[model samples]
Target: MHYALAPRTFLFSHYFATGLRIATGIIGLTFLAYFIADLPTAVAVAMGALCTSLMDMPSPLRHKFNEMLAGVLLCSVVALLVSLSSQVEWLLFTVIVLVSFLASMMVVYGRKAMPLQFAALFVMMLSSEAPSTPLQALRHAALFFAGGAGYMAYAMVVVWRLQRRLKQQVLAEALYELANYTNMKAGCYDIEAGLPAQMEKLVRGQSVLAERQQASRDLILRGRPTPDEEILVQVHYAMFDLYELVLATHTDYELLRQHFAKGTILPLLGDLIGKAARDIEAVAYAMTRNQPSRSNVDYGPELAALDAVLRDVPVGEGEDYDAQAALRATANKIRDVIAMIGRLHAATQASHGALPLVPHTDMTPFLTQQRYSLGILVSNLRWSSPVFRFALRVAMAILAGLVLSRWLPYTSHGYWTALTIAVILKPSFSLTKQRRADRLIGTLIGCMITAVILHFVHTPAILIGFLFVATAAAPAFLSIKYRYTAVAASVQALLLIGLTVPHGGSGVSERLLDTLLGTLIATFFSYVLPSWEYHNLPRLVDAVLDANRKYIDAAADLLLKRTGDDVQYRVSRKRFMDSLATLSAALGRMLDEPADKRRAPDELNRFTVQNYLLVAHMAALRLLMQRYAENLPAREVETALEAMFAEVRASLGAAHEAVPAQAAGQSTWIAAWPGWAPLQRRLRLLQRDAAQVAQSRTAIGAALGRD
Candidate 1:
């Protein structure tokens, strides 16, 4: 289905919902305070709400509440402290630097704490709006706390009421990404899109899919779901299995195109896969609307057509035979996908059965773990730590921005420069550069748009409506697209100031000037103690190898009947996928960096693809074993697989070592075992892929000047 056709599905998304909640809280509190008390009180309350709202992310209820509460308390305290010291210029400067450092340092605590940290820094910047006496500052802080707490309470209640719906939203999001991933894979058969480009797109999509799946896991796999929420849990499980099937569908696209360039089967296969993707998307759309999904397309015709085309192919030997086998396997995988979609649709209507009880002991490991302790912060205090360097960067940038702002004519709004710096500067140079560009362009566009509106229309009600929309759109798009967020934020900030402060003009020119200055400062400082992506490639490569090693062992264990599909095996698989995704993401960022900073682009790309194939081969092997375990010679197959696994493990462990010729040629015996031909073929493919990975690893070592 075309996404443009289903506007409500996108509107009901988790990101939009979060933004709308934040907008409602901010606008509701601001206008309510304005009408009941005064404009200043309304501004104070709105600032508080906005600060706390930054910490509102998709998480478990307990974490969400605690994090927002921490945001409210910290922001209020920061505002109060900064306000109390505002009378003394040097003291205020000291406070700003110290707060900036500490807040930026919170990255050591991981992602969840990031918003809380930013909330504190944000309030400090906002606190610079007006200097206040100690008594008046305390009153302002109290009002800030009131707005924050009030919004927190309101958000929690709203979340609680819609908790189930929220869970559905998150799960549906994963399905949406999975659909997108599948669609991207379908592009591989187009032949015209180019294999290298399609693979790059697929790799990037994998990272996004990994993130979405993790989010779904974090939410859906947390506490045991109630009976009413069981369908979501089931769909969640089915989605991951679907993702695995999609991964298993990976094959030599170059080979397929080379062999089938003149055939109709390739296009038919791509069309079928495309239809399957749409099927998944339709399910996601239904889930988003809290409705049961009914399949609207029949795949039988396409599958039959594919099968008929395959039947006409010569199936003796050579590339034609290999291509035929690959096409048949892919068609079967697609059939399985369509069947799984059917089951998934039924799952939305009613519970299939009780999901396997996840062991409590496995819960912590399954969900992304974050250590919220002082020790983590303390350990990251060293200069070698990226967080430490980032904190320093932020502090120095804030100081520079503050110093530069003092010389500007609009010195009263000098905090805008610092705020821009705070928002633009990130840990990595690539991200900072991207944010800098987005901030400048977004701010420029937003300024012109706001200026136009303010020039032509002066109706208070109309102006307030625009302000509400800009505010809502700001946080809503922050996670989705930061450029859009930047634009909305620019509009919102200008509108807020124009409405609140007396004789305040559009501030368009000032906004542009401050943003330009901020971006330049950010760009300059990004090179200061920057964390290069190449610096992390070796560790990430090792991580991928290690995870793959563990994954192979897990699959070996399962095949040998040494273990069931237990938590250990699941964790191993997850870590492998996660590591591969992490490596892919880092490579993506590295590509965006200076060309000189990119180490072994071709080698790294090969390494990433080899590792990806390794996982797919393992998944396909596991699936084969599961389906054919009853008929296969388990003992003999295990014995052969053990030898193969050892060779793969040794190659992974010693990056410089090539796969031994004897082991690489050991697949001859696989054909001798006629009873387990399917498993043998998978094992052979796995060995081949493992050797390629070893070669890629050795090349990476050479490129990186590693011994």
Candidate 2:
């Protein structure tokens, strides 16, 4: 599993910024504890830094601060509560179960809050043994909270001093992703490339692009200067134009091969377009590095040569309409794309400008319901909601874990069992199972390392220093590699245990035993009314169908010359892109399910594959329309195409309604696309693809009968 690196994704500057900041926070706070308070007091302060690390998500300074602030309160509150309730085991158990349920439910609200919630849970484990007394516990929480605040302050200073550099990094990443998107789109035009697979590749790039763009926007919103903001708007405008060009670049490989089967020129043109896309991607790279763009290089000579060749190519008339019309449309689309690329290249090279306002992004905001509202809670009570099902499953699992720990007469580490359940048990069974395996494997390995460390590392200063390093590395690797994160955390746990209570609880074997017990309980309880992906598949299918309908509607308008405003076109494309991503993501989750739980995977796979192919065909027709520019289709041809798109929509609309119950049949979305007329080959290609979709849906319907 190779990850794509952005221009400066793993540069020394980033490493220095992240590693130095974390190391400073932990080491400074740890020493302050040793000199100003006891080593245990220092440990408390160091524990506060855990919240700081968890909030190390790559976000703007403003968002980062708020997240850290929330972390401080969550950890402090959870620590205090655990400390206060420790005298009564049952009360503490109840608290863990309730908190676990609520925390696990956080993702349904969105990804923004999940990390903070999990981090708070992790800190609660650390603070559980802090102080038995209320006053001492409060002091411990305060010290830990201060440790977190110190880390946040250090971060604030870094961002404040290096805002532009940080902003550049964000912008660079966004531009890099845009380049990848363009290249993937270009790949689809290559005659030999796999359409099904290329579209999947395109989806991956699009998701990454969306993430980077959001990060860039967040930076722009981080109280930057007006000029900085205008610069961001320029970057945004460039990407917008890029997408419009992408929309206009629609092509069908089969048609391309058919129309120019005997020609070297068409294939040469394809190769040239691919080269142009690469050059555009190079421009994106240049933007990231703050270097002058290669877009300044003239494209006129190469394109002028191609134009001479095209002008000389015979427009064999009458029966050769398919070849002539397609060739002309293809040439026009490529020409326009080349022009857009040059414009973007020039825009990227220019450092200063009175940037025009690009339209605002169609991104949805972080949604929150009334915090204390019973209404929000009540609304999620249905069995249909994965969130509700997950909450119940987690609540049950946590309660069972608490019981298991207590029922075992010899194990004193009941909290370890609870922590394991909290960390490993996800709403989805496959995900929970994966985490359980990771938890156990990571725990066993960590325990072995812990035993060796305890045997050889006797110097207190060295141990503290090692703890500092472990603390700094864990959260940094948390998203990159969860296995590493698991190891870092386990090492921290063992180090703290050896440091604070060496004489009383020094055995790594006991920690391993508790981890084993927790893994079993989490595994067993994961199936307590698990939220299977099968339950959610219908909605995903519905989303795909609906997005296609809207895209076709917008494309029909473009073809008919009803409107040239790309606002609807862009919106429809976003919906289609977003839906494709979501459906594919769900399919991946479905693959992770137990064999018995996956009712009709082949059907789901076909649904996805056909949708990808159909969308590609749709893009081709749109491209021809883009090339047509101001010329409306002949009135009769325009009416027939509009009718074709409407019937497709109506057919899919029926399929969508019938999907959840597994009652849909093949679509009646078939029309020959005026195959005999003087219509464009692009429309005929769309017609063929749409018929295939209807047939695919029928096959899918047969496959989904089990549902």
- What lDDT does the true structure give each of the candidates? 0.82, 0.66
lDDT by residue (342-388, candidate 2, tens digit) is 77666655556544555554433311221334566567878877887
Candidate 2 yields a Cα-based lDDT of: 0.66
Give the clash total for candidate 2. 0
Q: CA RMSD for every model? A: 2.5, 6.0
lDDT of 1 by residue, 78-143 (tens): 999999998889899999999999999987877677777778888998886677899989989999
For candidate 1, give the lDDT of residue 21.
86
Best by TM-score: 1
Top lDDT model: 1
Q: Give the TM-scores of the predictions, in the order they appear.
A: 0.95, 0.79
> Where in model 1 is the C-alpha error above 4 Å?
1-8, 252-255, 351-361, 410-412, 664-675
